[model samples]
Target: MKQTDEVDDLLTRAGARWRADQEAPPEPDLEYMLSGGRKHRRWVPALAAASVAVIAAGVIAVLPDPKTPTAPTAQAPSTTAATPDARTPQTIAQGNDDFLVKPGDKVQVSGKIIAVPGKTPVFCPPLAVPDIGYPPGKEPAPSCPDNFAVKLNGLDLGQIPGLSTIKGVLSGEATVTGTWRGGAIDVDVQTALKPLDHPAQTELECPVPPGGWKSQPSNISSTAVTKFLAAHAYQATGPIFRYPNGTSRGAPVVILIGLAHGDADAFRQAFEKVYRGNYCVVPTLLSQSDEQRVTNAIGDVMSGNPKLGIYSASGPGLYGGRALAQVTAYTPEVKAALTPAGLDLIRVIPQVRPVR
Candidate 1:
């Protein structure tokens, strides 16, 4: 049989079964109709009973009164308004624009990772153009005024060789999540998309040196400088003689010591010891004016110019009767400048020296 015909046959059988299972309605009261009446009377009573039954049926059809109302079934939750499964990437450009990416912003930024000469292990590998200026008493301005820096914390750029020098500029695209921290935009590199191009060396304009050095002699005792240096892993084999006259140009001289690498505390301690020491051959011959000049020059080299390139400074110790300054050098510019100022410059060579 065809599908429709079979379905109809099955429905008909089911309906018949349903009807058979239901109880039959009571028979009509024919006895009441025949009793207490003549043949005409019986016919009238039957008609009246029929009319009453019709009225009752009509009333039931008009108004339905069920015993219990059914409750609405619980519906499954809709997934129509759920969060998106994918995020759209934001683009950031280089230069002096005020486009700041806040913490948790996923972005695609393209720029060159320019090498900062002296801000190593801290602000190294900053994402900027070369020759960024840092105004005195202010933060270093972004290389591209419109663009900001992305610090790749815990991410090794060294995996790509030659990335940390003036000879090379690492230009690439990175997918990152930005984090604003420590007054700068720090980024977590999700993916280094690609190396776009090699960076070319750009000329950096050095800031002009300040006029007239302000002298502030070290106040730290020689004992303190010696003790601090030894505690902080410095080879303190000095108090070495620089001036045979025990004075630098009629000024009492102290010992000069150079340090290749040390923090601010170490620098200050070394400066104080050398400045305060009375190691001059003729203590009376030592000139306070010469000592102040030497101290001022050291301060200028250490703090005045942002790019002075003297990692550490010490001394005004006696060297041939003239006050000399001992310093650790990472750049040639500092030596050139200090040498012209008449302060003897001793370059500290970096090496592991046995503790004395």
Candidate 2:
């Protein structure tokens, strides 16, 4: 009839079969029952019959038949693989792997834009193929190392005021997307350039003084001499100082002369006329020169064996001067020669004033 009545009927039939299959416990003897065992023996047979009925009902309710339905099981969520972002920046060295991409492959890279000596903008250009000369009036092709050059198209490197010279070692940050031809990288659409706060220092270890002065006169001019002294006069805040000559106190003065383009004779005459007396002059070389002469002069001074040396100064005008001493870059070659001669090569950087 109803589903509940049908279940009860099935359980009743199963329980009856289970009970028939089980062997009943033997009845206790009449004598044993009489000896106080009757109470414990009476409940044993009843409890056993009840347990069989309960087990049969549970089995019938839980067991599944061929046509019966079941609940679906839960499953875990799916996962995805991660990939590298193309927009992320990489170092110039890391991006220039030959095996990673083929020649003429387009890729993004970033690095410092360095300026090397030469009239052209490309720094560290590829070396010319020697023995095979170029055609007359035909310019050789410009080349660069894998990680070196960046195209100037759509990039404004000159906008940064800190970049003062195109001839010296200048450096700034840049990011560009370009095609890498065998020797040079040809930049295309996307690019960016940012100048650093301070321009890179020269390879030579020397101070670049500041404060602008009038150009030295072609001939020793009294007016030019006065102006030059006034421009470089000892300021309480300035590094250059007017010290008394060690040999003669107060009589002879030591002036740190920063010659622009005046000769030794012209500088001496101008100083004598301006101060109205003879003085010792110590000049600093601002440009590169013969490494051997510079090293010898510096070595003599450090060893307390000062020598007669000439310093060539160039600016708006050319000035050459014979000085008691001078300082310049002390390179590895200089150090090697001086060390064995028992000369201590002290690193001395000249003090310079800021350009006004």
Number of the top-ranking candidate, with TM-score as the measure = 1
Model 2 TM-score relative to the real fold: 0.18
lDDT (tens digit, per residue) of candidate 1 on 309-334: 23223221212122222222222354
What is the TM-score of each predicted model, taking all chains together? Answer: 0.20, 0.18
Model 1 TM-score relative to the real fold? 0.20
Candidate 2 Cα errors over 4 Å, as ranges: 1-99, 117-156, 159-167, 193-356
Task: Show model 1 residue runs off by greater than 4 Å.
Answer: 1-287, 316-330, 343-356
